[model samples]
Target: MLDELRNDPVILSYLQERANLTKGKIAEKLNIDTDIHTVCVHHFDYIDTLRMMMFYLFQQIGLNVVFYIPFNPNAPDVYKTWREIYERVSGCDYSRWECVESSQPNRGTKFAQYLDKCFPHQEDQLDNIRFLSFNHPTEFKEYLQKNPIVNNQNEVIASYEKDLNIYTDCTKSDHFYASRYGKFFLSLQNCKKTEDGIFLTYDDYVNMMTSGWVQYGSINGTQALTLLVDLRDYMDGVESFQNIMERLQSLVYLQEVSQVFDEVAKEQAGRHRLKCYLSNPFRCFPYVHQSRYQITVKQLIECTKDLARKVNRLLLAEREKKNVQLYLRELYKIYLTVKDKWEPSAKQKIEKLFSIHIPDHWEFAKEELYQLLTFYLGSTEEQENKILNFDQLIGKTLSAENIHVTGLSFKTFPWKTPELPSLLTHTWLKECIRCSFIATNQNIRINALLVDYYSRNVTRSTALYSIYHLLAYGNGQITFSYIKDLQENDGPSIYFMILEELYNKEKVNLEEQTEEFSWEETVTTQEEIPKEPLRNIPDLLWLDSDFCQRKFFLNAFVEHHPVYENDFHQQQAFSIIGKLLAEQGEGEELFRETMFPLFPQWTNAHKQNLLDTSYSSGLRTYK
Candidate 1:
């Protein structure tokens, strides 16, 4: 066996590490006449198998041999395998020994019990045979009763110690243990204990090897961490080995556990986001009661960061290029919007790069919205309507202005005149028109065009006016006379329904009085104002307010009677005129001429009338 091991440097190294095994060292220790060769297998299973194999071989050759199971090896050993002992010893004819030794009782000790039960010999032969079980070796020695055979036993002790010391010496001086290779092997042994009290050995970890038990596949990793540490101690003076082991430890410890960690991190992030949302919830306000885009964005940001960190670690350890690129790309998209929202200073520079801005506030006028819409439209590909089906159309429209398209129709040629099957997609067109005309503040031509489109419906005009009323009021100007014209007219092109909802929902109290008044009494305030509906008077007058001036082209063609009247009267007149205008688009010469002069600036003063209790009471009653 020693000659067979001569060519294997690893085995030779293990052998040479043994101390007290020198031919001269053995003589100094034991002064024995016989030579003994010893081999060490760290595992108890292998040791037991090898011992049995040697027993048969030595016995067959008629060599006097003794076997001893030593104590306290480098690591805890596992139970022995029955097959290794059985197959190797089969040629020894165990049946002959069994018959001869059958009468002797078992050892009754757990470790040696098997030997006693399986190996029986004649009582006299058993008496001559020595059982050197170490469980109570001192007691067994005393039982020997001072037989001179003890002298030979002491020699065996010297022999065993000599072998162990020789192995130790070999380990100390062996270059393999002192080289970078030894340190590299040691590095794999770095691992921490699991919570369940299972000590994770650095090299033998099932999870690390298998990517979780390593099963039938090779997990290809370092040794148990503790074992590696032990190896490091063995190579203490070897600088190369020490460096290799430390580097390996660093690599293993640096591994990421992936996105699961990111989600755990979100608890901290959510608090910050909640604070921002709560500050002005309606603005940046969080929807505590339900999930919101802000929450999703936050999660995505965290995930991206975690993935980014992982890729960075990989780049450092393995230089995995593909992994680095994929993660970097994802990181950019995740940060694009979050940075804009969380860090406003970074927004301006990257604004054109991405449409990260949230939707505008409700107070945005149709004209401004239209311009924004146009800009957003230009950002995407200019495709024909077909490729962008109803869903895509709805999505783009809603995303652009927060308006939902709920209904559709094929084609409704011309506005105002009723057609079958609602030929045009009503909801889509309404939303688009609302976004363009109402939200963006398009000109009179667009307004006229909208009127033409919805010509079949008188209330559509009222709805249009109502949206304008809210915007005007929000700007600090209550179009009282316009409200009246809208009230008296058979539903003006602009209505106050939205204002009513806003007021009801918010419970805002407007001090202005609402009263019914004859057109004659109302018009006396501004004789030059349009004599149209009370609603028309405000549009007739305030149409030029900084807020209303932008979309003049939308309602410009609608003739205004340049005479001021009671707001209720004006509202009523415009409602009627709006109906007439909806049914009859662009051709009212008398009204057109009356409205001509009021063009640039049209609002009339009705402060005194607004203060009247009767007027206020009348307006409330009308609603």
Candidate 2:
């Protein structure tokens, strides 16, 4: 990433003035201080800050930095993310630096046992830096694939706080041997609130899948344009399905292709779903297709016309009683020549359209052909649009006067393992468990990518000195605030435990909040439109009526809001249960009588609430 940035002309333009400057000249030009030394290191959460500091020291100021690192088993990603950030930063710019970590954690991790054997321990081993900073660190694996990963992170945040507070390689003192290491240990805390971890998390994914698209559509765009009357605009002079299909293909539409396949429901009151109709063609056709997406009207029309001609020839040959197989092969070849890979839906549709069979073994001869058709002719896809854009404000600590820090939520810290895609299990991702092999299908395999994307952040420093840098951006009047009972769909976490302990002091009168708190006092949020951003539900048994009923029950229960039932913690619990069911394929075959029993962990109240919802939603007479 750093390399890419350096290669970028814009970024290089930012650095060009200093590029030719010598070390002393660069220091003078950049106004960097050279006299900084005696750096003490804690967790390597933000390596960017460290790298930038080192660059100034070694490159401009010309001094080698000795880094004291710690290998915490519980926080290997701390090391891993450090390595990742180091690579990213140094790839563009870096300096000479060396690190000495716990030669042995002294306790009994596998790495520790190996190190303990390699070197002989002398008396007063704790005094040596090699044997220092090692503690009985917890394993990170204990937190993965929970009902949702955030639930697991609650424990992780609690565990890490303890690790920071009590444990060290040396004797526990008031300074805890702080000043002995560096004259000033930059005690940076993780407090700034963007989606935690460099890799995209669930919140980011959700943000991308909402409201609008990266680009809007024209022709068959928006809800108003979806009506049958609007189809004539693209049809131009001929009201043909082929004409409309040609105009719509590959072009972005605001309307989603209805998932419900009931043809009668599809033709509700004599038209397709009008919810996404392009209320104004002025906004749709020319602006969206011609201007926005850079797709001309002529291009869409020509593509569709070309596709129609091919299909008509096939139909004419069929009418003439010509060899249908030959035309079918040509059709398959035509599709293959244009498309990167053969799509199953394309194959199925073509076969069904011609009432012919396409053998899987047929390897159509390769040739270049302009594809005049698209798979999704009247559908909308999630065209990702950025929700938040932030500057790379990690380490430059020169600016001063006022600072306001935000996003101190648990969701943005301790780095919750992102919620895996539906119907994919953690066991499958980790060890390729075949007890229920998920990679058996493409949908499940694609979900595997989510795991890969998320797993990288496992070691990438999520909570770097971001908070420090944010505060340093404007030094004076530092202000940060977090709600005790935030409407984040969470309750008391380990952070709360720390607070409970703090408030337990005699000077403070606050007691441990063991009881349920009111939601109205916390935060208020409004209900928005339900978005089917995605679902990996197989087009298999879940499509069955009985199975659909069960799925409905599960989804309804997960999505149930008890009319102003605004308890965020309860919402979190509900959302978690929904994720567990989807990932584990639960409740799909359960009878109403046995459904509650299957979820033994769900409390009686939850079960009752679900029952109430089911009844109120007109799903009466549960067996």
Candidate 3:
């Protein structure tokens, strides 16, 4: 690559200009100019995945990321695939990144790589040199136990004396939200006993390997997170991974039985010390919740930063490229408006965090998030820069562009599924609860969930708004993709009808709703549709679960786990109740008993009319 570059006219001209400029500058600084010099970047190209791009941006961490997949010597690894690809594509031998037993890791200091920072070797810098490495969690934990480096610097004890490393922010002003996870691991080095006792539950596990514990983790939107875990996540009323994301909450203090150090949380000895070793935590964890506070300001900031990246991408697309300067100016104005509105209060809150200082520098991170917005606005200059992205600034002015929107499919895009579908129709399930039965966890919850999903807002204008606004981002021909026909018995998403309502119009003013959707017409049109149609598109799922591994694991666990005969009784309740409800028979008494709490005025008359055979079947389905 260097040989080819050296021969290129572009390189020659650039090098010659740099040489002449450097010579003149050096001559002026000194007495006379005798020799010419060449100037070029000492750093190599930092090739990395798109996932790592955003953080490299705000944190300004100078990391030359290289992708490496180590081979498993005993079994097949990525080494074989790369070798075959190289042989087939380029017909060359590929020998990089093979992990043979004899091939030892580079045990040199990581600071050794940074020439500008560590090369000159200022005596003060030499004493404080930190080597941060990105390594597997198992290897990192092993280094902490075995490596003789007791280099505890501030909040992190990075692996400086050897090959493994725990990543830390170079700038103290920016606190990597994930750093707290390392501290929790670091805290394990000390056995801090708690008299109050730790949270213990049935067959619990502190699920690390979460994106937060990962070093050089996936950069994809589906797997990345700015914050490792939210301690105050319990406050959320919604059903999210927070309900099951016990990354830290599951930590338990335990002592080994018979000195094996493999005892689970259930096993313990009287008057024994808490085991804080990594090796001890297969069945027992070392640390427990020390203190609780209604605090997660850092978390909030990190969440906001993540949201800002999303909003920034949208606005960048919306930018008027015909007048780039004016577009940036307008965006800056809006940014300033938000900053001005939120700044004073945010400053006070941050100041309060700084003033009330705690050990481990919990809130010691300086006010640096504002710089993110500053960087965002300043990035307009480097529109071609990957992080900033080319905001249509580099494209040909004469070229035609088309804006295409996809995933206009039903509930997939806007995702307006009822917030609490079980509550909507399963009010009757409370009777089973009164009889000491928990209906919420039963399979019958799906009867309401599925029904609520089908009859979900045909009136929701979000689909129209999103499509129009997203298209407004581009000054070009607009087109969209939609699932016009549902698979087999299913009909197209109800959103299709909602979108069609807008498409038939001559003009749409979102502020003006000309008329409400005619339910009679919608039902009449659906009369010829097949029965038991699918509501959602189905596919095999694994990695792309919106980074919620807990949900994925739990879902698969529930499906594959062996079921008792009695469990099937509750599971079949959904089909039975759904059949009776559509027939408008038998379950009127159940609804009266269960739903009276919600609507005490409702009576059997409501149910009889609801189930009336006189009504059209299609109309009854919508009802």
Best by lDDT: 2
What TM-score, over all chains together, does every model reach?
0.16, 0.23, 0.19
Q: How do the residues 1-623 of candidate 1 rate in per-residue lDDT, one tens digit apiece? A: 45855866777786675422454454456676766454322212122222443443444344444322222111112112222232233324223222212122222122222212332222211111111111222332332233211211211111012222222212233222233222321222232222322222323222232121111112112223222332232222322222333433332222122123334555664654332222221211111112322222223223323322322322222111233233334434544424422324333323443444533322222233223333532323322111121213212321232111111111111113334254555455556656766433433323334333333343222222222222222221222111111112233112123323333323222232469777654444535756565453333335444456534433333421122223344334333342333334463344344322221112223221222222212211212
Candidate 3 Cα misplacement greater than 4 A, ranges: 1-22, 26-35, 39-139, 142-623
Tens digit of per-residue lDDT, candidate 2, span 375-432: 2121133312111111222322233233222223465444454454698655555454
- Model 1 scores a TM of 0.16
Ten contiguous residues with the weakest lDDT in model 1: 406-415
Candidate 2 weakest lDDT stretch, 10 residues: 182-191
Native-to-model Cα distance after best TM-score fit, residue 532 in candidate 1, in Å: 55
lDDT of 3 by residue, 1-623 (tens): 57966987878997786545434455576676564243222111111122222322212233233333223332222123333322222223454443434441222112222211222222221111122221233433443343322211111211111112221112222222223222222222121112322222211112221212222212212122222232222222212223223222222111112134434422443332222222232211111112122223333333324433322321322112223333334434433323332335333432333343223412111122223323322212321101111112112111324332322344444444334334443344435534553554333233323223333332133233223222223334443333222123333345444444433422121122258676554443536655344222122224324566664554334331111123233223223332344445455466445322221112346434433533333312322
Model 3 RMSD in angstroms = 33.0
Full candidate order by lDDT, most accurate first: 2, 3, 1
Write down the lDDT of every candidate, Cα atoms only: 0.28, 0.32, 0.29
Q: Where is model 3 poorest over a 10-residue stretch in terms of lDDT?
A: 382-391
Each candidate structure's count of clashing pairs: 111, 18, 2
Best by TM-score: 2
